[model samples]
Target: MSDTEGVEAEVAGAEAYAEAVDVLGPFNGPVLLAPVTHNPNNGVTDGVWDVTAGDRAAVLKVLTRSKGTTGHWAASDDPRHWNYWRREADVHVSGLAQLWRPYGIRAPRLLACVERPDGDVALWLERVRGGPGTRWTVRQHVEHLRRLGVAQGAVGETADRPWLSRRFLREYIAGMTPGQELLDDDEAWRQPLVREHFPAGLRHDMVRLHHDRDWFLQIMESLPRAFCHLDMWPANVRSDGPGSALFDWAFAGDGALGEDLGNYLPDSVFDLFVPAARLPRYAAAAYEAYLHGLRESGWKGDEHLVRLAVCASAVKYDWLTGMMLARAGEAQVDYGGDRPVSPELRYRERGSTLAFLAGWASEARDLAPRLGFPEAPSGR
Candidate 1:
């Protein structure tokens, strides 16, 4: 038989095949289950599976956290206050996705959810059939961003949910600041591989952002805040028949006006789902689309501030890349999907990621004259 048949046969024979059997009941036939590709984040060991249960095919997201795992803003590994998994379950159960169905945004149907006392949960969700946002073209990505902006722009503001992390960007970036694990790992930057990975035009700015803890916090917080899919990357989004579906609500909360695009613009390339060279094209498209969406949704806001926010928000990579450098022991920068740099996941894609991060710096520096934020001379 062909390779496809061989893999199917292997999947049929493997005992790993029957994970949620107890939870999902007997399938209509031999259950076809395979691991869904996802990036590893700060919190848990996630086993997101695609299972064909009888006539129905669904996604089984198995979330687990160990005693040693810690919880932070977006890293909701801890079950108690930082209920990332529970929040997602609640979002589906509460019919929040339906509210956005008209806005071209949607979430998967929650089929079954099992929560144990030990802070572990298993979510069986409807395998939203269609293309993932990662596969969308630059124009598609822009349209989706516009729809997202209109959707979120319409949301305006509201009373805070206690479950929502109040200062998400603040807390998420805190751990990687000076005197933190990120700066402590700066010595690793001395390595030629790690050093060479970044462009010379960017090295000083990258380091500046790393140590300038106060600026990152200040600018991100000062922007026009709104409810957003804090994690707006392609992997967490999918394109439905004519609509779109966004998943992974763990990071859905208040964010800068255009912060989601910051995630979207860079990540479309960072995930290596989009061609690296086209990243700038995607970034420009997404930016204009998002602004158009905001305007269409009746947002009477300052374009300059929004632009500044988008640029500053790009600093999201400051801590992330530093973490990769710190953790990358004397190894070749293969640019594969490993924890520290796993988000980029491809050698060819690394430059795009670095350029995007640097773009944020340069753009932000250019916007500072308009933003009126404090001046820290960027050694251009």
Candidate 2:
């Protein structure tokens, strides 16, 4: 068969396997049977099956070639991208599992990595025992933040690929800004929302941000590097009680220690439907808990600097928000999951939330002296 035909056949085989597993039980009896759904909303690449047969329960994730590389898959063209994708999948599952198991951080236990006859990959994992019981409470979310902090600290210096280092974020921000016009033209659907939140003046600067790589690199070198989940939002985080399980580690890499902390605080606060007024209190507590975990994990640095680095990371997201908004008119906005991209659903409705974070940053700045950090630096 030609390579194209071979890949097509592989895709068909994967689908057939999924169907057979759902109808029957395990193929060989030791395995389980379950129906898997393709998560199109996120990336639409893989099918996620909720597999259960008696005491052994797991999620069987089947992947053929991806429509693109928001997640892991072999691209027939580029050998490097192919290697990077596969290496990442194997390393992330095994590495984080090894790192977190000792510290009691919850993650799916990796069962097996099955390479298909036609060069596709399937990852079988122990399913999370129980998902968060209801909508997460504010306190529960705060505790989850603390746990994430512990996990981050525990992940210190484990994987040291410099390409995934501080420079990666810096360069990414620089590259995306100039492409704003293309994004705006291609992704016009987001214009209303982007224009509503972002002023005209700032929008121009969005494109010019490509010129300011120096600031990004300066910030990068100053920040202490730690192992980051790189995708630590509420969705990837599952919880029961104060305990939580973190999944989806395709982007796991070394990053500034507080990157995930800043990412988590806003996500947990917003997604849990926490009251606006109470957000500050919860944030402060999560920040404190995260610092404590970092200290416990043997980090030797000025804690205040780390906090500032975390805040600046928010600026990175601010840049990303503009980019996504610019592309809102595109056929799909890639949110980097198993599903196809959709609208900026979370940020669209939560203007108040972003305002809250800005306010929290201002307050945090005022309290910086008392907290042993200098006043917030000024720049756009």
Candidate 3:
């Protein structure tokens, strides 16, 4: 059989079905498997399927290191790489995902972690039926951020794990080959969304931000560190009853105390889940709530320091505007789907987010000196 046919046969085999049923509980009826659409950019994921046997359900995520194609952001064999192929499996097996239950955050329960003869790992996880983050209210977003702060604060110092990602932001940013030329292309900025949302001042700020990316990375290195869910964005989170459950632990590691909040705020609007106009209000409230949670967890650090880190964390997206400009002429697709979306809508939403992040970049520069980093980096 061909490779594709072989994979299909393995996935449909009775042995795998029985294993899933064993962990998912005995079923009185036949088992069914349906493929689920997930992020396809990650090369490690062989497939993801929703497994159903009678009333029981589970998600079977097959991870393999054999994929031939490799995007710049694709999974790496290096254990400390930001997108390590086996990180999520290690996270579930080590019970790290359950450590934050007291802080009102958790990961989906692991039903089984099966190692296959073909050098793949099949992660059987409880199918959480929570509401998608796109449907979450502003209050829900704030609460989730606060909970994340509490959890990170409680961790104090992360244990030295060989597999934990190091220099994640720096390395991940370096991987992206952004279209730097588009930053100065006047015509690129003339696109409808860019013209309306990104003014000349914002454009200038974004360009400077891209140039000073290393400066912000240096500043983050000087700040207090904590265990962080480095990829805590809307699409990776879900409302689990009254609390939240985060998925995709591929980038979990040490980071600046408030770095997760920084990622969360901009990402909420990046895909238009939250309106761009409400960003300031959300940022203000979420920052305060996160601070409160940190304090409640016995953290007594300087709030200004956290604010600076949050603002400077905008450096993480320094390449995004350039990438958007390069793609501005192309037809847009909905996030994680093949469905076509209006280019105008896509650019308008994402451009507004870029403008907002540019403001944060400026704030980071201003805040840096006050935090005692008086010598600005070469780009500034």
Which stretches of candidate 1 lie above 4 Å from their native place? Answer: 1-27, 30-32, 40-42, 65-85, 117-119, 177-197, 327-348, 366-369, 376-380
User: Model 3 scores what on Cα lDDT?
Assistant: 0.80
Q: For residues 238-290, what per-residue lDDT tens digits would candidate 1 score against the true structure?
A: 77877788877765666788888877777667556687777776778888888
Q: Higher TM-score: candidate 1 or 2?
A: 1
Task: Count clashing pairs, candidate 1.
Answer: 1
User: Candidate 2's residue-wise lDDT over 1-380, tens digit each?
Assistant: 00011121112244445544654445453343444422343332355566544454566665455546442222322222212334334554555544665554666667767776766667776677545412566666667766666666766667554223334455445534533455345345336656564433444343333233354445544577876666566566556334777765655666777877777766654443455456668778878887877677666677876676665554454455454464545654222232353344443433445555555344444554565444444535
Worst 10 residues of 2 by lDDT: 1-10
Worst 10 residues of 1 by lDDT: 1-10
Sorted by TM-score (best first), the order is: 3, 1, 2
lDDT of each: 0.65, 0.53, 0.80
Model 3 Cα displacement at 201 (Å)?
Answer: 2.1
Error (Å) of candidate 2 at residue 216 is: 3.6
Query: For residue 296, what is the lDDT in candidate 2?
Result: 73
